[model samples]
Target: MREFDSYPTPEARERELADLVAKASATIPGTELIEYGRSVEHRPLHVVRVPSPAAGAVPRVLVCANTHGPEFIGNRVCVGMLAKLIEDPPPPLRRLHERAELWLAPCLNPDGYARTHALDGVGSLARLRHNHRGVDLNRNWPLPAGARRLPLPGAGSSTPGDATYRGPAPLSEPETAALDQLLTSQKFHASANLHSFMGTLFPPRVRTRADSLAYARLCEALRQAQPHTRYLRIASRVFDTFTGEQEDHQHHTHGCWSVCVECFSFRASLAQSFARRVPLFWRFNPRDPRPWVDNDVPAVAAFLLAALDLPPPVSPRASRTDP
Candidate 1:
């Protein structure tokens, strides 16, 4: 797990991700690894599927991480579970994965990861929350297209340097399109896109209203499973002011269960580490945040187990269309 913090070069990370996938495919007879699409660098976006070939299974669980470059510890956690499920398949993981499908998008923005890593020496702060185009992958998702996508540039401006810039249009990037294809191709029971920094759990349907209660419930349960994470629904926090979000697109359009988890912090100081451990404590201010040595892996694993046991929620009522 310390490999998660070793800060590999962008190429090394991609190679490691591919190696993990290949190893899993070889180790688990039922698992298959497919390349969804390529990043701007022509690096393959690996989507490892467990028992996707298995027929007659109910809805499956799809967990992905690293849509952004630097917030990748979650990606590491996802990859670890994936490799474990396939490579040294415990009877539980083997049987569960046989009945479930996991789609791990390890390094979704390879171009950004590589470029940023190069910019500041292997895997630096530049990799956080943005892709090669300087756009935030999480913030760039197409909302219910139409005027609802207010403020044109939404939470942030379209300036390339902005952290949350929405691209020219929805699905303008290969990453988004590849993700769309993955969602359309399968019937998923539940899905969560992991993140780090704030340690907050987010849901696609974020409002506190009745229409979104169930979604909130799911998010809360997941967060509760990981005590380190505090539940912070987007609608309540961002006021839908944050437009073009992946979670909303997945929830409103695809009826897919999705979430955005702020996985860890960027601060590296001891004070920062202490604050994260006890956010309520005073006099503990951090500068740059580094990932917690031990992440929420165990809790996240348990949550996945519970989520898979539940049925898929009703998809949004809108006519299905790739966003």
Candidate 2:
């Protein structure tokens, strides 16, 4: 696994996470591995559900990755954290997983990932930000309350073409449908969606004004846990909040502390973006000089652990409602 971690291609990211699920399930007795649904290209939508199943009392948490397809760092970090949790989880994580449930979806857009992997025409593949139908899985989600369309940029945004389309309607895509239903079925204590290329931690639906008190509280918990993170946009609505980003839908609809974290700088930062662009699976040199930080993985892992330890912003309500 460590060998694969050094350099993982986008296509290989799903393959590796699937492998971890299989291994982890076999090792844990009550663990439930479910295929929520299939992607547009028939890529299995897999999630490792670690639940007590005793019912009543335990809350739920969903930790996901690969929702953006090209953002590959979360895939590695999710699996790495899972491994660590199994072997030596901190008190918060151990207890959280033991009492509450952990729903880990390491890859959401397998097709987009596959396309991104062979972008050089090395495999005659062009990356897309959409599912098979060319829809953005994130934007197609249905918000719980009556919310308007996501605030988007221009008609043609520089956003990657791979999978950011909002589709014709909310819950129009299977990926969003599966997640929306699953998340709604039960209230999650907190949910986090992982991404990459931004060396920062942020909340969903950044508002234009001061950090919404709700988001600010969650951000504080994360920042205090790990002081190294580039805590930006503490109180800024996303410039483009049009298409019902998954984070917004999840937080507003379920009233869960829905957070979306960007992990590395392969694309977002010119300073070291070139380094991450190199296929993680491709052989590279430790001695090779690159603008990068070694803390990406640990930083995220610690933040997650801290989240588990912190008290909920409010005593557990039956559920939260926003749209």
Candidate 3:
């Protein structure tokens, strides 16, 4: 019975998140708490808006985490970043605050998070990847035009019980639908969906050379801005297969610069592999999440600032075939 004392219980985390949002709303002049939608288990999906005081139209950035149940480190990063913004933002974060409106969706799959925590550090891997209705929210987005299902493994699955199960149809799950709605309404200039244990920044599927170059530049900015260990930039080449991921939908349909930040590290996974009886949750999340949070929170700010510096898109809504 390994005690995960370092990580907060699901109930405690929820309370802390609510408290943080309340504090920000009360203390920060332009902060707001928006309840976008409800989950399968009737849990409220919320986003905290920290609006910029910059005049005229400003860039907006969406930072979301915890799409996968067991990868709670991403959630920790979001909360920690929010705390920093509320208390004392560092140089990059302060610059981001001055230039962009930031929205934080700390836990996109709250039901799945609670379910994973209920396992108490012991469960099958399948239970740690899906929502209460067993759908992988990350894989439930709309696929881009000309993007076909590849024969490659880990692309995503159509099966219900599998880890990457994409659900019966695109945007079928309530969690994904709620996120899609937010993206549609907000029309963010840039976004980062946080995941864990890959230590890589994956851009959305690229269809053209120009798109690929743009993502490469954006990811390079993220890498250069990290105060600690930098994540590898796994930019999409021309032939990368579309996985109906949120980042792809954001980039293709909304013309937003979106990337999936896979936090923690593969090296950490290798180190944990030697431990006996390590639970599936522990494999995805570290026992102590502070270091990863410290490393990633600033990178999130850099991601937004880089996008804000880019030339404004000709149109906010892009066709599937548009680059």
Best-performing candidate as measured by lDDT: 3
User: How many residue pairs of model 2 clash at the backbone?
Assistant: 23
Candidate 3 lDDT by residue in tens digits, 36-63: 9999999989888988878888878899
For model 3, what is the C-alpha lDDT against the true structure? 0.82
The parts of candidate 1 lying over 4 Å away from their true place are 1-5, 52-55, 86-99, 121-129, 145-147, 152-156, 206-211, 227-238, 265-294, 309-311, 315-323
**What is the RMSD of candidate 2?**
6.0
Ten consecutive residues with minimal summed lDDT in candidate 3? 314-323
Query: Which digits, one per residue and each the tens of the lDDT, describe model 2 over residues 173-222?
Result: 77877777777676676777876555555576644343256566555555
After superposition, candidate 2 runs with Cα above 4 Å error: 1-15, 22-27, 52-56, 90-92, 120-126, 150-163, 206-211, 227-229, 237-242, 265-268, 274-323
How far out, in Å, is residue 48 in model 1?
0.9
The TM-scores, one per candidate, come to 0.75, 0.73, 0.94
- How far does residue 78 in candidate 3 sit from its true spot (Å)? 0.9
In the order shown, what is each candidate's alpha-carbon RMSD? 5.9, 6.0, 2.6
Arranged by TM-score, best first: 3, 1, 2
Query: Regarding TM-score, does 1 or 2 come out ahead?
Result: 1
Residue 200 displacement (Å), model 3: 0.7
